[model samples]
Target: MTAVPVFLYHAVSDNPPRWLAPFTVSPRTFVEHLNMIADSGLRVVPLRQLVTTLLGGPPLPPRSAVLTFDDGYADFASTVAPLLAGRGLPATLYVTTGALHASGTPSGRGPFPSAATLSWGQLRELDAAGFEIGGHTKTHPQLDTLPRTSVREEVGGCKREIEDALGHPVDSFAYPHGYSSRTVRTLVWETGWTSAAAVRGPSALSSNRDDPLRFARLMVRADTDRKRFELWAQGEGAPVAPFAEGLRTRGWRAYRRARAVTGHPYRALPTDEG
Candidate 1:
């Protein structure tokens, strides 16, 4: 069997009443979740270390796992950081350079659902503190929509920025908005990143031709109950769905739903555009 699942998370919150909007696993809940992973005998591996180990001589633990957070939320530093440290677990934090500070707007993904995104300085602290830091992008732009030049710049520039800040190479990436494509993956590899993550779930190994930057992820969300989270982490819950073709359709449907609820009208992208 494959070593272990790669789990992705947003906010490990202390008090997120609903999993829908806030997307936080309350700090108390987060602790429980962490304890669960720890007790399950899984090695909480960082992405780089996991990759390096698998490529080296020895095999990994039967329950090895990679914990990665996208968007560089502030809670990562203020909340999740200490907890992982206490458990002696290593984590990889993927960040969007745009949201690292006061430079860009927050995601509709939620209202400050992750109100605590990290800054460049905070990122450096995390890097210096031994947390592995990686890139998302400068503006969190959808990688597939941009032209080739923009894709290269967005992918490369953010890695460049993080490396410049932390004095270490940013060798991995997570697609912004969980969005990517063949073109985007090519650009990511061209940028020389070792690996990259996607929002899809049910983790497995990539074959030789698989894009190094296009790995999938499972989630232990704030809303997940212990049983479901366990099943998910164990790869027995829901099978990871291939969702690349659903983007524009789902997004447009969601937009329409929001508009209808608010009694507002909107124009969706032309049917041919997606």
Candidate 2:
């Protein structure tokens, strides 16, 4: 069975704020990426549909792939959605509800930069336009560091909020910072989400047999050139899995230990590392 690549993005802008500039892709680059996928004869499907096909609902199309964006950045509505709409592609947007209400401000005293989270109005428009909106917790926090109760609130609360705002069910989730432990996974499952996405680590699932909860995604940052992006689109980007996982595992442990000492689940600073 051939694995489908789930491409992950954060913001789409040529003039991204200082802190998030690394993760943000220019609009031209985004368009090029979309064109690459379309020209590759690959089908760009919704993440939920991809999951269903992977789980036995239907045989996936040849070279099926998924696009997902995290944090519900304003650029998603302004930039990403337009390009996706033009391509007739579907994507999943995972929102941190707290940020939506926080106005145009960075959540903490870090240089994370000030940007507007998507408004309720914008989210509703996206839902109406055939995009899936998933939960990324009430506030973007490291789920592994929080107690189970807080984890439940963060995960469950965000789902309920999106449902209330959109008048539809949210069936998917993506871990903030791509961090989750077994307990966190269980909490997400109990909250009624059918699937969840994580950034980095291993390559994407080669078949339906892979775990649904820990679905791996290829993090596409600003620096991803056309050659590397093509490698990913063609599903030939797994050559560096061992090296990538090694770095991810070490960074995850260090963050876990640091959070343990600070008793803080939320990160105050923006990072170049995904």
Best by lDDT: 2
**Over 4 Å off in model 1, which ranges?**
15-22, 53-59, 102-114, 201-211, 240-274
lDDT of each: 0.66, 0.76
Per-residue lDDT value at 137 in model 2 = 88
Q: For model 1, how does the per-residue alpha-carbon lDDT over 1-274 read when each residue is reduced to its tens digit?
A: 3535677777776643343334567788877778777777666776775566434535556666778887777789889899888888888898877667643544323222435567677788888888889888876665665668988988999888888888877787888656666778888888988788775422332222223456556655545689987765565565433324455555754565466457673432101021
What's the distance in Å from true for residue 194, model 2? 0.5
TM-score of model 1 (CA atoms): 0.76
lDDT of 2 by residue, 1-274 (tens): 5667888888888777787877788888988898898888778877877678646687677688889898877889888888888878889998888777433434332122376567777888899998899988886777777878999999999999999998978899998878777788899999999998875453343334445676777778877888988988888765322123466676775777577768764453322233
Which residue pairs in candidate 1 have backbone atoms (N, alpha carbon, C) closer than 3 angstroms, thus clashing?
13-25, 13-26, 13-27, 14-27, 73-116, 74-116, 74-117, 196-213
Please give the lDDT score for candidate 1: 0.66
Model 2: residue 80 alpha-carbon error in angstroms: 1.5
